[model samples]
Structure formats: structure tokens, C-alpha cells
Target: MEPDDMLQTVDSVSFDRLVLEDSGRMAVEFMSYGCGYCRTIEPIVQRVASMIAAEETVLRVNIAADPELAKRYEITGTPTFVMFLNGSEVGRTEGPAPTQSAVIDAITRPFMS
Candidate 1:
């Protein structure tokens, strides 16, 4: 798939649906539209997601538009990634990071053997 195809930016409603009905494991990045840090790491997240898109679902949710979802996850920062497995949260990583590798590791660790 194309690189951009690896990630999806979803709305509050869709986010809920994806989180609950995703067939396999998934990771969602909670970011605000005006967050500089979130913008800076957007490409990094997309690239890493592309690398593992075959095995996982990667998404980005605009926290500003999804306050309730953010509250449910207890997200306090931009660029927070919450990973779900079988419709249940399994792991999470918060804040912006220096590189995609570290963030990717953090988001995927729970499903790794």
C-alpha cells in the first residue's frame, strides 16, 4: 500500500467504531489540530505505521474534536498513542518523541512476542 494509506485520521464517531470493531490490533494517536508537536511527529507516525500496516491498524484522532474519547482514554497530551487488542486497550504511549522508532516500539510492544 501507499505510505499515506497506512494511517487514517478519524472523527469522534468513527474512532469509536474503529476501536470497537477493528478485526485485529490497532493503535490510535490522539492529537490536537494546532499542536506543533503533533504536526512535527505526524510524518514519523505515518512512516512507522506504513512499515507495519499489514499487521496493524494505525489511526490519528483529532483530540480537539473528540474530547469525550480523549477523556475516556485519560489522554493528557498531544501525540498520545493508545493501542487496542481485541477491542480492549492494551498499551499506550504519550507525548511527542525524538524518533519514529521509539514511538513505534512503544505502541506495538504489547502485541509483540
Candidate 2:
């Protein structure tokens, strides 16, 4: 799938169904639009989404708008990547510094390995 197609923009309202309720491995990026680090890693996240297996998915949560969700995840950074498998969190990487390898490992390592 295209990079954009593989990445889904989600919010607190839809987060449960899209991420926590999903039956496959997935990565959810908790971020904020005004966060420079979040913006810096957006492209790398998209690229990682496209590179991962088709059954896997990538979702993004705007912490600015979904503060509750961010709080639920205890996100203190702009680009926190959380990996879930079969509706439960399995791994996480809080920041990637916009590095492709870091993003890839953050999103893929838990399930891909």
C-alpha cells in the first residue's frame, strides 16, 4: 500500500477500535501538530508504515486534541511509538529523532522479529 494509505490518523474517540481492538500487530504514534519533533518524524513514520507487512497498520494520535489518550499512554514526548499485538501493548519507543532506522525498529521490532 501507499505510505499515506498505510497510515491512519486517529483520535481518542476512534483509538480503541482502530488500535486496541485490532486483531493484528500495529503501531500507534502519539504526537502533536505543534511539536517540531513530531513533524520531523512524520515522513519517517509514513515510510515505515509502507515498509511493514500489509496486515500490520500504523496509526497516529494528535496529543494536542487527544490529551486524555496521551495521558492514558503516559506520553511525555511528541513522537512516542507504541506497538500492540492482538489488542495489547507489547513494546514501545518514545522518540526516534527522525531517523529512519529508529522509526523502523520502533514500529516493526516487536512484531516483525
Cα-based lDDT for every prediction? 0.82, 0.82
lDDT (0-100) at residue 50 of candidate 1? 81
lDDT assessment of candidate 1: 0.82
Number of clashes found in candidate 2: 0
Q: List the residue pairs that clash in candidate 2.
A: none
What digit string (tens of lDDT, one per residue) describes model 1 on residues 11-110?
7777768776776989988988699888788778878888888888888788888888888889988889888998888888888474977877877898
Sequence-dependent TM-score of model 1: 0.88
Q: In model 1, what is the error at residue 73, expressed in angstroms? A: 1.1
Q: Model 1: clashing residue pairs?
A: none
- Candidate 2's error at 18, in angstroms? 1.1
TM-score of 2: 0.88
How does each model score on TM-score?
A: 0.88, 0.88
Q: What is the lDDT of residue 50 in candidate 2?
A: 80
